[model samples]
Target: MDLTHSAQDEAFRREVRDWLETHLSGDFAGVRGLGGSGREHEAYDERLAWDRHLAAHGWTCIGWPEEYGGRGLNAARQVIFHEEYARADGPGRVNHLGEELLGPTLIAFGTPEQRDRFLPGIRTVEELWCQGYSEPDAGSDLAAVKTRARLEPVSEPGGPRQWVVHGQKVWTSLAHLADWCFAVVRTDPASTRHAGLSYLLIPMHQEGVEVRPIQQLTGTSEFNEVFFDGARTDASMVVGAPGDGWKVAMGTLGYERGVSTIGQQIRFARELDAVVALARHNGTIDDPAVQDRVTRARMGLEVLRLNALRMLTGPASATPGHEVAIGKLLWSTWHRSLGELAMEVAGAASLTAHAPPYELDDFQRLFLFSRADTLYGGSNEIQRNIIAERVLGLPREPKP
Candidate 1:
């Protein structure tokens, strides 16, 4: 792929940059670089307002089709938008589950009615969403999900049938703040593994549903444990066909690794720059080992960007191939290593908190939170398994 941008692309980039510079000031000025990964709890309401600000100006979902209430930006322009957003240190998006993952999945697999019902909410940032993919036993082994949702008649006469979901989902990011959850549930009890699963759109505010925040080592509750006693959605709320959830869920995962990753790498670049600056301040930059690690981190980031671009240029499919797994493995490992590097640069000071009430400095937060980088979003082992089985055409792992 050509690395150089066309004049038009450059012009679009400038437009995005100017808009961010102008708007990410005044009331939104303090929100830059707030809310991301382990730090998602920061300025959440304000960040949400910032997200709406982007949506109001027609900046959200730039890659969705124009009819779906997006800018309908092509691949190049989408990349430009994300890159510029990160360059301006835009607040971490609170609506990504809606915009990046679920919206695209719906567009690809949803019925027209489903699209009309959900797309506008996502595009306008009026309703927030959380993913219900991971469970206590099914984190990386997504196909092993045991959450069951069975359709039953509504109590009101002639009302629509409802999917009564009963199970628990752990590591549900931002569930407390979301209005809805797209969950993978076992709709067919007789079926096993990936066969019986269905992707159901569940409402979060109902009495049968409960969201309990899980405080992390970072002293924040960005993730939650969501319990569903008898949570429900309209029977028609399932994306794609009922038993075809394995396909829809995988498609959402593909979207999870989509064009927005370019922006993510830009953020990672910023984090790396901070680490290097810290090293310089602490005189660790003069140490050959620290300098070597920093240089390696820089090279790894470049490689990650190139790989992501390569993936973007490939055929647009909901089912991501081994390349996605490779990218996941690359970035997660690199980020975890960068965190360790941050601590090494901080020297002994990393051992202590910066203030009372257990306030951690930026470097400390980076180090502590990044320990889970390889754990969540598919462990390194899982990624390797994907590469081995799918890409290398190796024998499947034995089912125990």
Candidate 2:
């Protein structure tokens, strides 16, 4: 893949940089570097307003089609935007689940009416969303989801049918703040595993839904446990046909690991830079071993960016292949190591909380939270299995 930017791409990069530099000032100046993994509880309301500001200026869904109220930017341009956004230390995005994951899935598989109802909200950052794939027993084995939803007719003679849902979803990121959840449910009670599943878009504001924040080592509550007891949505809210949920759910996972990963790498680069600076400040840079590890970290980051760009250049498909699994494995492992390095550089200082309420400095939070990097999203074991069975065409593991 060509690594050099063309004249037009450079111009687009400059435009993105300039806009962010200009607007991320004044009242929004305080929001810089606020909100991210393990730090989503910071200045949430202000960051949310910043997201809406991006929406009002047509920057929220740049990769989406123009007809869907997006700028329809190409892959290169989108990468430039994400890179510039991170370089500017822009606040973490609050609507990413809606804009990146759910929006793309709907555009690819949703009905026309579904698109009309949901696309505008996502594009405008007015309606936030969360994923409902993982359950008590279905973390990485998503097909093991036990959440059940069956169609029930409304009392009115001509009223629409509703899907009454019941189950528990854990590690549901931002569910307490989300307006909707696109869940994979067992629509066919008798069918097992990946079959008989359906993707349903359920509303969040109802009596039967409960969201309890799951506090973390960082003393933040971004992930959540969500319980559904007879929660309901219109039957038409199912994205694809009944028993097609496995397909739709897989598409959403593909999008989750797609082009946006470039942005994450950019952010990781910033974190690494900070760690290096800390090393220099603490006189750890003079240590031969520390210097060697820092060089390796830099090289690993470059490799990650190259792999992500190569994946982006490939033909787009709804079902992600082994490349996505490979990317996940690489980054999660690298990041967890970086967290360990951060603690080493910080020395004894990393052991103390910043204040009384279990407050943590940036490095402390990074060190603590990155420990789970390999676990959440998809575990290292699960990703390895995907690469082996799906990409290498190895014999599938026997199920008990």
lDDT of each: 0.90, 0.91
**TM-score of each model, paired residue for residue:** 0.97, 0.97
| Per-residue lDDT of 22 in model 2 | 97
lDDT of 2 at 328: 89
Cα RMSD (angstroms) for every candidate in the order listed: 1.4, 1.4
In model 2, what lDDT does residue 112 have?
90
Clash list (residue pairs), candidate 2: none
Residue-level lDDT of model 2, residues 54-114, one tens digit each, is 9998899998988888888878898999899988999899999999999999999999999
| Ten-residue stretch with the least lDDT total in model 1 | 314-323
Residues 282-339 of candidate 1: C-alpha lDDT, one tens digit per residue: 7999999998999999999999999989888865443565678888899889989999
Off by over 4 Å in 2: 156-159, 316-319
lDDT of model 1 at residue 244? Answer: 98
